[model samples]
Target: MDLQKQLNEDMKQAMKNREKQRLVVIRSVKSALQNEQINKGSDLTEEEVLTVLNREMKQRKESLHEFENANRDDLVAKVEAEMDVLHTYLPEQLSDEELQKIVDETIAETGASSKAEMGKVMGAIMPKVKGKADGGQVNRLVLQSLS
Candidate 1:
C-alpha cells in the first residue's frame, strides 16, 4: 500500500485498539499529507511522502531538543513518542561508516577539494542519501571529508 493509505489504515487500527497516542500521531501525519496534496494540487509520490515524513520527523527532533534543554521532560516525552511513530515510515538510516564512505565517494565524484566546494559535494550526495540519512549528519561528514 502507498504510504498515505497505509497510514490511514494504521490510524483506523490505532483507534480500534484505543491507542490514543498512536492515533494522534497517525492522524497528524494524515492531516499533513492531505494539506500537502491540497496545497500542491496533486497527489504525492512515494518520495514526496517520504520528504514530508522526514520534514515532520526533523521538526519533532528539534522540538524534542528544545524541550529537553528547557527541562520540560513531559513535553520531551510526548515529542519522542510522536517521533517514534513518524520514524516507522522512514528508511533505515546509514551508519556513520557508511555515511562517511558515501561522502568520500561524492567528494571524489565532484572533484571537491576544499571547504569551498562543500555545496558541490552536498548537491551531489544528497540525492543518494536523502530519506536515509539526516542532513546535519551528512553536512558534518561532508565538512570533515572536505576539510
Candidate 2:
C-alpha cells in the first residue's frame, strides 16, 4: 500500500490498540501530507510523500537535539519516541560506506574536483539518493569526498 493508505491503516490500528504516541505521530504526518497536497493543488506522488515524511522526521530530530541540549530528559524521550514512529515510514537509510561510494561516483560523473563544484555534485547525487538518505548526512559525505 502507498504511504497514506499505510498510515491510515496504522492509525486505525493504533486507535484500536490504544497506542497514543503512535496514533498522534501518524495523525501528525497525515496532516502534513494533506496540507502539502492542498498547497500543491494535486495529489502527492510517492516521491512528494517521502519528501513530507523526511521533513517531519527532520523536525523531530531537531527537537530531539534541542531537548538533549537543554537537559530535558522527558522531552528527549518523547521526541525519540516520535522519531521512531516517523522512521517506520521512511525507506531504509543508506550506510556511510554506500553513501560515500555514491558521492565518489557522482563526483566523477560531474567532474567535480573541488569544493567549488560541490553544488554540481550535490545536484547530480540528490535525486539518486533521495528519501533513502538524510540530506545533512549526504552533504557531509559529499564535502568529505570533495575535500
Question: Total clashing residue pairs per candidate?
Answer: 0, 0
Cα deviation at 129, candidate 2, in Å, is 0.7
Residue pairs whose backbone atoms clash in candidate 1: none
Q: Give the worst 10-residue stretch by lDDT in candidate 2.
A: 58-67
Candidate 1 segments whose C-alpha is farther than 4 A from its true place? none
TM-score of 1: 0.97
lDDT tens readout by residue for model 1, 88-130? 8888999999999999988889999999989888899999998
Q: Any runs in candidate 2 off by more than 4 Å, and if so which? A: none
> What's the TM-score of each model vs. the native?
0.97, 0.98
lDDT per residue, candidate 2, 29-63, as tens digits? 99999999999999999999999999999898889
Q: Among all windows of ten consecutive residues in candidate 1, which has the lowest summed lDDT?
A: 25-34
lDDT of candidate 1 vs native?
0.91
